[model samples]
Target: MTLDLATLFFVTVFMLGLGGVLLLFAWLQNRSTTALAWWGAAFLFFAPATALFGLRDNLPEFWSIVVCNTIYSLAYGLLWTGARVFEGRRPVFLGMTAGSIVWLLASQFSFFMQSLPLRIVLASTIVLTYCLLFVWELWQGRKEGLMSRWPVMAMVGLHGLFFLVRIPSVTSLPFPIGANSPASPAALIMVFGPLFYAFALVFLLMALTKERAELYQRRAANIDSLTGVANRRGFTELALRVIARSNTDKAPLALLLFDLDNFKGINDRFGHRAGDRVLVVFAKTIQQTLRPLDLVGRLGGEEFVALLPGVTPDITMDIAERIRDSFAAAAREVDGHRVSATVSIGTASATQAGYDFDTLYAVADAALYRAKQKGRNRIEPGRPSLTMVSQALES
Candidate 1:
């Protein structure tokens, strides 16, 4: 079936309008990502631009050529701005408006306005620039690991290539300005191409948003709300992976379990708020003392764990001591209440405690108990049981 210009124009408008409404609904559902709002507006602008293109023959030259193309250019510019916002970059309002400004000024020249080839090249250049800018913005966020980004990039890239080829194709064609009728081949291809592009992009954009939402949901589940560290479940999953890797590589790994000393007394004297501040301070201190490769998690109230890969028992002991000293210093006073906080740490190493997280945690927990029994604000070492060694080997 042959697609007439009117059919293509209505399809383009429908797709753009549908995309805009869906994106607007998405934006309303989650107002955090401003990119969605911008993209929604872009699609809205594109719907009108497509409608204006279909009505160009009935409208004045200024409305048909200058206003119509300017709106179309602004639509792509908004898409570029949305990409910039997605990547945490500042949107260029003046740059986005520049296309309309340039088109309006150029349309004032009768020769430029009357020549179809010149008009096509000029509009294509502006649109192509915005398309490439969108590509660059998405490419900048390549490290984010969004699976939908690849298809979005490919679609935008090919759209830009279409405009790029249009520059030369229009220049070589013998078509006149009046030849852009509903039945013309060029008009049909131009309208149909964007119709397909817009529909595909809407799906891809929704997929991207879904991917980000799922990622954030997973992180929220894994993260401790108060301390911003890994929760118990997250720590176990990550630490076990580290343990498995260490066992495979035959690298030394250490586990340190820590509990804040006199935590109950602080909460009783100063209140739970002060207790929370102390915990936050101690967690921060522990994070600062450890290497980036180390994993730390809050096991429960005032209880934490750290898994250190590539560290021996002696070095792990020293690191634990450092963490203890730093936390003690940092937690000396919370909200100026004169609350002195200290942490007791237990150290165990894979070489002695076996490579399993459970075995290491058991030894470390025993040593932590030993530290508490001896005195608070101290470190203790625990030896792995023979049973743990056999279990680790079997596993």
Candidate 2:
């Protein structure tokens, strides 16, 4: 099919303009990272670059060859900068400006400015470098598990390869070349490739933003605001998964339920703000005493749970005691006030308490109640009785 360059240019300009607007809107809504703003600028810069190319016949040779290409180079550089920012890396402004600098200096030479193939080769090399760097930046963030990132990387990588291949073809092929009208296969690809890439890239960018939003929402739902531990719902979800894994692996699992003793009294004596500090300190102490693989969560105010995999009943009790002692020592002073606090922990093992989360939780809760009844600031072993199971089932 015979492609109309003017039509392609207009379509590309419109697509780039629309994409830029959408990205800018997304930036305004989130404002979390500068990556979105850089990408928005990329699209906006690209629109005018494409427009300048379309008007090259009408404009001066210097504007068409030097200025237009410089802007185009800046667009690709910003794309690279955006990728760097997304990956939490500092954007190198000098590296981004290098391509434009090279083009501007090279354009001053009459011989360099006169040869279209030489200019295409230089511009293509600069753009390809930026594109590859963008791919590298995205690849570095692979562990984040954002699936949309893979497609964006693939698209940019392929785009780079297209330019890489074009360098050789443009150098070899003889075609009509001028500021106003450049009839060549490379020129056609240049116009059409970015149009398709821009469309795909905009959608992928939106997908990335959506993925991040969903991740934040999930964390907010599952995480305790004050303690920075798992919330009740998150604990249940994670603990259930751990239970299933333990059952399959035949590994012992233990659950420890903890409640702060005289937590209400502490709040009354030291104010709610001081009480919050005590809770934070207690949570940190619990985290320090456990293995990295172990999971801890906040059930509610002054109530927490810890799940330990591959632990025996005796070892679980010892760990619980350690946590209790550590928290008790740590909570002696909250916000420089003489606020004393202690934690009561009740532990249950999978072998004795059963693998079911609800059953185990009920046994632990019962044990916790017993510990409170006997005395605060104590660790108690859960007794998984048939009555407890029945009660859990009923509840």
Candidate 3:
């Protein structure tokens, strides 16, 4: 089979340019994902670099050899920068240009610039370093549980490995002298390999952006923007799963429902901003008081709930009391306003209410009403009666 290097070069340049434009357009539509812009610029840079490399015969050795390789290195470095941005880290401007600087400096030496093997080694090393850095940045954010990240890491990792292998293969195997070298197997592989990779990389980049958008939407739906905790829907979904696990394990669970006292009065007296500060204060207090594994959510305005797994009735009461005390203390002064906020808490246990979220919630809510009736800022226990029924269902 015969291959036309000029045609392939043109195709690569066109495709990379198109991909860069598309990515830049995507970034314009959603300015939050700044990584898209960096990635787009990287692709755009790659187009000119590929052009310079392919047309090396027509251009001066300085532009074709030194400048071309430096641009390629810069593109890879930008890719690493994009990875850092994607993971919410600040881009290291120095690091982004480090590879190109090193390449340009090394190119100053006539012996260094003249040897093809030496040139290939340096170029491949720079690319491999950037690829590895990209992989590491993504790996650091693995806790986010983004499924799209794994494939990106794998692809970048494999690409890095290819470069690593190429460093050794360039010396041992029959390597082509340049891109236009006639249809040698090594030359063909070198020309086509990056073309296919660029295509796949652009596809993955689009997929990654799409995944992040979906994740943000899901979080927006589930999370309470005011308190930085779960909303009612999110809490219910998570609590149901916890209930099922507790039931399967025959372990006890506890639910604490809280209602802020005089919330509306605070808004009326101190202003809505102060009321917001009080809510934020209370949420932070409860979160700090609870165990790490415990789940808490804002059920609605001025009302919040928490679910504690594997907790006894006595422990549940203790936790509820602690939360009540902590919140009262924290909400005493909100943004220089004497808010004097307090909370009434209701406690229910799986031992009494069974492993049903609704049953536990209803019982806790009743207890909360009693706490409010008994002059707020106190904890009340739910009336226990469903033990036998729960055990029967379990059997």
Candidate 4:
């Protein structure tokens, strides 16, 4: 059974209204995701805009055609604004209203008012621009790795393509822009396409919000709040996986254990705020020194760890030395204080320690203890145990 245009319009209004309320309620639960509020408002606007378009024959041309279509444009503009807001960009109020302004201005022209195809093209182009803008904003934020983002992009892109197709297909429909009597292919697309799109996008947008919240929760669990590095739990989880991979490939790995020298003295002397600054400084230094693939984490206060895969013992020693020197230099003046903080690092290679996180960690921790005993701000290499030595001799 086919749906008539009037019934389709009613369904669109009801669905859009329901979708709008759900989105707004979701926004109330999490005010940080302001994109939901904007998107909700856009859907609300569509409900009334669809109603006005449906009642075009009974209502005045200004209210039904011009104003209704202008609301449509504004709604699409709001969607684009929501996309920008989702990616932490400022909403362009003027840009959001520009489509409505353009529609209103063009409606005043006699030539524009008389031509049905021209009106369809202009309206479609306006909505298409916002659709493409939404896609572009999402594309720019692809690094965030949200699963829902891809489908939203594809949906908006296809919706935009539909509008582009609508421009050329408008020639086939009857003139004067009355109610779709028989509902031609273009008319059916006009009504049904948005109906389905609005329905699907509501669920997709909710999924996007859920995915982001989950991602943030995961990050919070794993990341050090003070230093913005992986915490102990996060490091352990990631490092173990790396170790397993190294073992499988028979590739070498290195672990560097770092401890700040006289951390308690610095905290007691300068206060905890200054101590925090020192930690941040050292964390930043190590992250800058290491490669992107390298795992750098703050195990706890004044202690950190780095796991480097596919690296030799000599290279690990060099990296540890570089990190030690960099932290010492960088922590000299942190947050405008005379915080001459220094780090002691211990290096361990998988060739000696074996490709197990626990084994590597034990060796590195022992080396760290040695560094503390020798003095502070020194790099020490872990010595292989007798078992490892014997295995090496046999090999």
Candidate 5:
């Protein structure tokens, strides 16, 4: 079988196009992320597109070899960006890749490639340098707890180097590192290159799919299916985390628990449809008023929780006031009429007595009970619950 670079270029095009489609899927499913655009651009223009067209003019020339190797290098580098960023690492790979590709391109000068003595000296040197670099990155990934991420990348990197130097004229140069050996670079690459990179890409897609599925499972576990807010499960999770962090950091956090006033009457008079609309509208209201950094979740029907981190009592009161007014302002219009509802918020801060996630939830719950008992449409806080519990315990 006669294997040529043309066949190689054709197959990479298909793989790159497939990656572009998945990146689009990621962009649409979540909020706008910059990585999606970068991935799309890399696949569309750099990887196979350049290889297909750029290789035509310079076939078997140094530049053709350079272009093909550059694309593969760049693809590995671009693919590494996803590997790093998706797991929250600095974008250092882009700059490093630019430097590496630049140096490799600069070596194509006739003087550089022609010097038999210099070529041999530099060939071993360049090989060692890049091999060390790949090893260093692999070590870093393992140390940083990124999970089994480096293997796929290492496979891409090693195979890429194999494909790069295998250009007919170039493969023999610098005393032909692999040319003199029983195993030829072209033969080895033909045996493994396309399929190796293909396997790496497949591995990456598997990693991405696994990540998305895990994220979905985590979200579903914490969120209410009907209301799309944190359910009791999520509340326990946030509480444990906030409590553990608060004890360590000693920074103030707060929780506001509340329920709508006269909610049942609306359901009784207007129907459960109106009540559900009120819940959705209320969730929307709380979501809008609070900073995106804050977390809000519907605990159950008519009851909600807003976890506010780093807020003092005074600031929290101001927030509570706004939430109260914001909800009243957010009246629902059904079948041509404005239907009004009110809320009673129980607010508690970390610095206060019984200042913890559970205590805050309890206090807020007690305050809500009082708000309903004392007539409704108001705000209360956590001290009341602690006091009642203390008295009951003493009694």
Candidate 6:
């Protein structure tokens, strides 16, 4: 193995392509919209690194210059973007990236036209400074957390080292690569080129995939194990946002608070296992009854909340009443014996209550309490159910 620049470039591009494909698949799985930013780096790596040799030598100076200029710039950008994707911000770095781009352009063209010591000096300064910055980024990443992702940090560090060898010497490849490259012992200009970028692409894809998995895991944590609907925390988060936006748009919002009626009796009569079955069945019935804009969540034992955004009071009430009737019709057969279940529902309309989400929840809760007081298996508005009270007084 000659370990030449040509070989390094080829392997580097190949690795970058592989990384891009992996990252694209991972991002697609998560449906992250920002993942498109990776296409810039992936586009450059579609060809093998050795193919870049022809571009460096064959084309005019400007294209060649652009080619090498973007090499480490894209590498660093990938590291930055990966960090941003993981932590929502770029990690710290010690190098001057603007100077490096200027250096790459100067280095590619200096040999073609003239001998410039000042150019060499400036380029070397950029490379060495970037090396120091790479060390700084690694040190900072270790000290202020993110130590667990050292391999990701190392990907950045190696990129700086790529600049170091490529800049000062301007004629050699990195260590431990290009063992059998055709460009090895052949092309001087192809040394230490985009190999580091390939390194970055792979790491970027891996880091992005890891980020998606973590997000999915976090989402799963906020879901109820039994019904697989959003749990109380996720529901509250969704409801607050909906309420805020509904207020802003002057749109209507509705809250539905419902609980199983005599659920304790079901547990005592049929066993808690049967009670759980009823909860699951009741959840399914409500899910089937909801509109696309509606969100349902189990707050805790036997308690549930629903947020209906952009619906009229009549529609919301109708939907709630339908869910109530449907739940009543659902029969659970345990050990060849059929059992019936019912729910107490209380609803509050934001059109009537004004813009406060907490107020809506409170009013809905009060309504639910009213429903329970009047009789189980009935519906109540946030305000007192005067009709039920009137009927009771008449009785």
Per-candidate Cα lDDT values, in order, are 0.88, 0.87, 0.88, 0.88, 0.63, 0.64
| lDDT score, candidate 3 | 0.88
* Model 1 regions more than 4 Å off: 174-183
Per-candidate TM vs. native? Answer: 0.95, 0.92, 0.94, 0.90, 0.58, 0.53
- Ten residues in sequence with the least summed lDDT for candidate 1: 174-183
Residue-level lDDT of model 4, residues 1-395, one tens digit each, is 76687888888889988899999999999999999999999999988998898788899989987999999999999999999999999999999999999999999999998877788889989988999999999999999999899999999999898778777777764432222233466456657766896789999999999899999999899999999999999999999999889988989999999999999999998999999999998889999999999999999988999999999999988888888888888988978888889988888898887876766887889899999999888989988687755554454
lDDT of 3 by residue, 337-378 (tens): 877899999999888878777778888998999999999999
lDDT of 1 by residue, 281-381 (tens): 98899899999999999999999999999999889888988998888788887798898899999989999978888889999998999999998799999
Cα miss at 5, model 4 (Å)?
A: 5.2
Q: Candidate 5 regions off by >4 Å?
A: 1-186, 195-201, 332-336, 384-395
- The TM-score measured for candidate 5 stands at 0.58
RMSD, each candidate, Å? Answer: 2.0, 2.8, 2.3, 3.0, 8.8, 14.5
**lDDT tens digits, residue span 1-395, model 5:** 65565556566666656656666566567543544544554555444634544354556645444455455455545555554455445567655376346647756697865554454344334433444454454456454443444664565466545534443344454323333333445443443444454446555645644555576678798988767878877977777686667757877888888788888888898888878888888888888899987888877888898888788888888899899999888855643446788888888776773344556666677777877788877876656445745543343
Off by over 4 Å in 3: 177-183, 386-395
Name every residue pair that clashes in candidate 2.
57-180
The residue-by-residue lDDT of candidate 2 on 1-395, one tens digit each, is 77788899999999998998889899998898678899999999999988998888899987877899999999999989999998899989999989999999998899998878888789889989999999999999999888999999999998898778768787455442222344567577667777996799988977886896787789899999999999999988998899999988979999999999999998998899999999899889999999999999999999999999999998998898889888878888778998879999888888886788888888889899999999878988999998765664465
For residue 366, give model 3's deviation from the true position in Å: 1.2
The TM-score, computed over Cα atoms with residue i paired to residue i, of candidate 4 is 0.90
> Which pairs in model 6 have colliding backbones?
1-179, 2-179, 3-178, 5-191, 9-49, 10-49, 94-133
- TM-score, candidate number 1: 0.95
Alpha carbon lDDT at 240, candidate 4: 90
- The segments of candidate 6 whose C-alpha lies over 4 angstroms from its true place after superposition are 1-194, 332-337, 384-395
